[model samples]
Every structure is written in structure tokens, then in C-alpha cells.
Target: MKVAVLALQGAFIEHEQVLQRLGVETVEIRQLKDWQQPIDALILPGGESTVQMRLLKELGLYEPIREAILIGMPVLGTCAGMILLSEGRLGTMDIEVRRNAYGRQLGSFHTVDTVKGIGTDVPMTFIRAPYIERVLSDKVEVLSTVDGHIVAARQGNQLATAFHPELDDGTRLHELFLGMVVGRSDKE
Candidate 1:
């Protein structure tokens, strides 16, 4: 029931707040030691992808996190997080993500859309977001799209979204991630 939120950068606190409101225990992961805790799942929040990756490596957390996800540790990645998990970075989620696909900060906006398994009119807030340019694996399921661009997807225990679900009041996305976490625990 405990989730680790990557606090090295970005909207991590927002994710933690949402998870907390859902009554889930959350731990901020800011260092390699934090990753040692008994977390049932992990959240990679939105931020600058390049900086996040640099910190992950410098802090000696990159490989462990990636390997953990590959081995089925449930993870929810948002914005830059989606980029982090894409083909070239963590390389766990088989998707190619284009960073800041929505141009600059001025391009950020909000809208309501349907996320595949989450019902209709899901509020989505995009801030310097990225989009899945192409899915490299058949196992990856496209969850939602905005203006024909892939915005949300799930691959096994890994869930990724270009928009910040934490920024909105909706719990479907976070709840969906919790479902993945519970599903993982059940299998064990």
C-alpha cells in the first residue's frame, strides 16, 4: 500500500498528495537510500527529462529503478516521466516519446478527454508535455489520445501519461495506477 514518489524534481509532491488523499502511504524518494524502503510501487513525476536522468545517474538510482520496472515493479510515469521510461532513457516502456511536443510553456492547456479504461471526460492538463510518437511494442496499450496524439498508455505494470494527472482533481488515473500496484501484489 506504500508508494515511492520520485522527489528529485518536478510534480512529485502533487502525486504524493493525490495518493495520500486516496489513503495510500507515500514516501518521497530523493536519494538512493530512499529506494531501499519497502515500497509497493513507484511514481515518476513530470519534470525536465534531461535533468531528471542526470540526477538519477549521479545519485546511483538509474539502473536499479530501470531493472525494477523491467522485473515488474508497478510504476506510473507522467510528463517527463513518460519520456524517462521511453525507448532511449529507461527503455522499459516500448514507446518513442517526443519531449515538449506541445511547444513551450505557452502551449500548455487543459481539456477533458476519455482515457480508455477510465471512462469519459477525464480532465487532462498538459504542461510542456510529450506525446508517444510511436509505440515500439505490441504489448503496449494506448489508453488515451488528444488531437490524435497518444497521451496515455500502459505496458504491463508500467503506466505512462503525457499529461499531469496529479495536477487535476481526478482520481481515475491514480486509481488505475493503484490497481496496477495491487495487481502486482496479488500475483506475488
Candidate 2:
């Protein structure tokens, strides 16, 4: 299976490395043309959400990608990507996310937390992360929380996390996303 990692900005390379380690083929999505390729899933890496959104629009990729997600494309959004998916009125996951909810770079931190359905004590690295303020729709499933803050959730084919799972050694979150991709593919 092939996954597309948004390479316009952020920790996209890390996500690619993680996918490669899992023996999954990956393609870097840097332009509108990149979206033309066949991809089993998409990874919106952690980065500055505002900038990513602007770039997405300027590159003429915003609508196509959004339409794909609306049609049930499996997407895993991390950190700023979470904000972009939820906050910029994407409405794909039925979530409400607050950008930089943890403050700025000064507020960045690391913690070992339990990611629901992934097991306990997973390493989570937060760099200017955003938390799910509320799940707007009952269809959204809260996946993990840290210090009472909603940090992860999933709805249908879309998964989102406030923490940068790619910044850590554990690949459980990526594996979980792959599971989502595989599950959807099987149904097709």
C-alpha cells in the first residue's frame, strides 16, 4: 500500500521514515500534481497549520484533498495537521480543535501516555500541539487523553492526534493508522 505525506512543511520526513520502516511505500505530496497519484492513505504532518492551509490553497490542492477526505479517504493528521483538518472548517472528522492549545514552542513537552486502543505508556512528543476542544458529532471517537486534555480521536476513515507520534520511537500510532487504511481497503 502507498501513503502520501504532505511535504509542504513540518515533520513529513519523519512520518515517511516511520512508514518506510513498516515496509509501506510512501510518496511525498508537495504540489497539486502529486495528488493525482494513487494513494491508499494520506498523512498530514505536524507543522504550522495556517501556513499549510495557505499553501494548500495557493497550490490548488485544497479542494481536491478535502473532497477526497469527504469521500472517506483514510487520513492521519498530527499536531498542526489536526488543527488544519478540524479547525479550518474541513469538517471531515466532526471535531473541534484549538490551535496551539499547549502554547508556543516554550510550552512544548514530552510525556508517556496511554493511547486508547493502542496500549499503555506510549511515548508522546508535543511541539506546539493542539487539542480537541470538543467532538462536535457523536460519530467522533475519542482515542486518547493526557492530563484531561483530548489529544486523539478518530471518525470513520479519519484519525487525528495532537501529539507528534512521528517524533517518538514507537510506531503504534502509525500502525493503527495503517490498520485504518487496510480496513478500508479490505472493504473496497
Candidate 3:
């Protein structure tokens, strides 16, 4: 299965490297033509949320992506990606995310925590991260949190994290997203 990683902005390359390490083929989605490829899943990486949003729209990729996610295409969004998919943007997932909830670049940090369904001590790196402030839909499931702030969550086939798992060497979160992709493909 080929996965599409949004490459307009953020840490798309890091995510691609991690997925490649997992033996998964990934295609970089940088333009509207790239979005035309057959993708089993999508990964939205950490970066400037507003900038990413503008680029997505400028390149005519915003709607297609939102439609894809809304139609149950498995997606994993990290950091700024979380903001992109949260309320007011893609709005594909029923979540309210507070951007820069962890402050600026100076507030960046690393922490080891447990991610539900991915076991314990998962390495998490936060950089100007945005945490889920609240769940707008009952279908949303909280997966992990940091200092009472929602850091990870799942709703339907969408998985979002407030931290950059790709910045670390762990593979559980990527594996979890792959599992979601596989499960979705199986159901189809």
C-alpha cells in the first residue's frame, strides 16, 4: 500500500523516512497532481499550520484531502497537522485544537509517555505544538495526553497527535497509523 505524505510544509521528510523504515512505500503530496495518485492513507506532518493551510488551498489540495479523510481514508496528522485537521480547517475530525498551546520554539521539549494501543514509554517531541482542547463529537476517543492537555486522539479513521513522533526513533505511532490503513483497506 502506498501512503501519501503532505509535503507542502512541515516535517514530511522525517515522516517519510520513518514509514520507509517500516517497509512502507510513501509518495510525497506536494501539488494537486500528487493528490491524484492512488493513496491508501495520508500523513500530515508538523509545521506552520496556517502556512500549510494556505499552501494546500493555493495548490488546490485542501478540498480533496478533506473529502478523502471524510470518506474514511485513514489519516495521521501530527503537530501543526493536528491544527490543519481540527475545527475550522479541514474539519474532518470532530476535535477542537488549541494551536501553540505549548508556547514557542523555546517551549519545545521531549517526553516519554504511553500511547493507548501503542504500549508504554513512547517517545514524544513537542515543538510549538497544539493540543486538543476538547472533543466536539462523541465519536472522538482520547488516546494520550500531556499535563492534562490532549496530545493524541482518534476519531473514526483519523489519528491526530500534538507531538512530533517522527522526530524520535520510535515506530509505534506510525505502525498504529499503518494498522489503521490496513484495516481500512481490508474493510473496503
Instruction: Point out where model 3 deviates above 4 Å.
Output: none
Ranking by lDDT: 1, 3, 2
RMSD of each: 0.6, 0.8, 0.6
- lDDT (tens digit, per residue) of candidate 2 on 117-170: 799999999998899998888888898999899999998998999999998999
Better of 1 and 2 by TM-score: 1
Candidate 1, residue 29: how far the Cα is off, in Å: 0.7
Tell me how many clashing residue pairs each candidate has: 0, 0, 0
Query: How many Å off is the CA of 98 in candidate 1?
Result: 0.6
| Model 1's TM-score against the true structure | 0.99
TM-score of decoy 3 = 0.99
Candidate 2 residue runs with Cα over 4 Å from true position: none
Sliding window of 10 residues with minimal summed lDDT for model 1? 30-39
**Predictions in order: lDDT:** 0.95, 0.91, 0.93
Instruction: Give the C-alpha miss distance for residue 81 in model 1, angstroms.
Output: 0.5
- Error of model 2, residue 137, in angstroms: 0.7
Residue clash pairs of candidate 2: none
Ranking by TM-score: 1, 3, 2
